[model samples]
Target: MVERKTIFSYLPHLILLIGIAVVAFPVYVAFVASTWDPATISNGQMPLRPGPHFLENYYQTIFVGTSRTTREPVGGMMFNSLVMALTIAIGKIAISIISAFAIVYFRFPFRMTAFWVIFVTLMLPVEVRIYPTYKIVSDLGLLDSYAGLTIPLIASATATLLFRQFFMTVPDELVEASKIDGAGPMQFFRDTLLPLSITSIAALFVIQFIYGWNQYLWPLLITTRDSMQTIVIGIKKMIVTQDALTEWQIAMATAVLAMLPPVLVVILMQRLFVKGLVETEK
Candidate 1:
């Protein structure tokens, strides 16, 4: 019976391991390809060992030659991406927390209907509004600028919804006690609610940060010039050469680079994320 119980406990873990590998195999292939020369990739040869050319591919993508002229470097494009992503992440978190707190804790008119309407926006993806959004950005003279890319996405339904749901799990009794002790709404939130909701906030942060970081269509549509482009956009361009034969190696290398920042953020926040969720249940 003990042995049978042990098998049952391990079954789910074994399945998850298989699932992770299935999802990760393509990423592994891309990383391996990035370490090889384009010539080897084009010839359909699989990488047997890591080659010295990976750094060469990375350096070429990030820097211009000695007699450089007429283009921004890949590293500069990546910096733009980082700035945009960080801006959106911070702004979205602030807005979502405020909106969620208001809806959950404060009394307001048409609040339920307004919240539902905003939640519906999640159904309509950016692709559906591409042309109209482009025209609006251009009309506002925000095209090819960071403002165009970051401002429109500062409000997100998913974040607000997640935060609201989490906030509801917070006890009204604790909030009432704070109020009795002379805590105003803002004071109540700052002193009690926000501290308790840290885990849910961390989880939401990871999800929203990844969403902003991986955003492609809206940024690409708004920014036409290479100088204003993000890392993902530049990587997309790098994949296709002058004659349109894809440079698979360099493209893979850029992809690997772009994926690293978010992965690191998630890994760092994972402990807080688990703890937060556990606290929410209490």
Candidate 2:
């Protein structure tokens, strides 16, 4: 007789299957909606079928045919999103690595207190601090600037803390051996520490990249000019316009477009990220 699976093993798979469906349903609906016409969407049509207008909608959304101020093309929007996300990711890595190295390897007075101050920012999310952050951005003459948008979120306390924790696992003998061979702090970090922490760094890179890519509310609040608008802002602008009704098809299309980068990044890096986690256990 065939053996039946136990509830314990089967239950987790059931939950995961449900979760996957829940997450994928919206994306599938959006794709289907993007292919349909605005009239069909407005008329409460169900099971939206792919129409011939799919290419037309995509073309109009992505490329410019007329005026510059009429709403950004999908290409420009995607480019802006790519640049911002990459900038944030690179900045986060540079800043966090230094911060992690300092906290993990160096000893100084009131160091714990300093780390805590940064950590506390995590508790009060960007939402809570928007008023003050906006003011600070304005006062610094950085409003609508890439520096203002990117710099505020450049350093992540969470990345530093996690890296520090992982770094603690590295053998002190390695540092001592390097020092005995006449390596300095910078050399040791670059030649020894970083090489050993690739997994942790890869893991952090994926996480931070996603976090930066998905940032919407902060970008919306900060960027005023159309030129400064990122993909998320462009998507929002397409959905609700002061002059006309919401264009549901284009909005969904824009969303689907915006999602590609992060999704592709994760898919490409999933192996490294997972391998990093596996190595972390050892």
Which candidate has the top score in TM-score? 2
Q: What range of 10 consecutive residues in model 1 has the weakest lDDT sum? A: 64-73
How many residue pairs clash in all the candidates, one count each? 1, 0
Q: Residues 1-282, candidate 2, lDDT per residue (tens digit)?
A: 366766666777899999999999899888888888778888787464666678977887788511223366778767777777888878987888888898888999988987898788778878888899889999999988888888998867777777778788899999999999999999999999889877777777776677777889888888888777787878767654452477777788888888987888778998866654454343
RMSD of 1: 4.3
Candidate 2 structure, TM-score to reference = 0.85
Model 1 / residue 51 / CA error / Å: 1.1
lDDT tens digits by residue: candidate 1, 1-282: 455566579888999999999998878887888788877888887665666687887786678411122245667877888888888978988988899899998788999987998789888887888898789889999998999999988877877877788888888899889979988999998999889877677776666677778889988898888799888887777654453367776677778878888778777888755554454344
Please report, in order, the local distance difference test score of every candidate based on alpha carbons: 0.78, 0.78
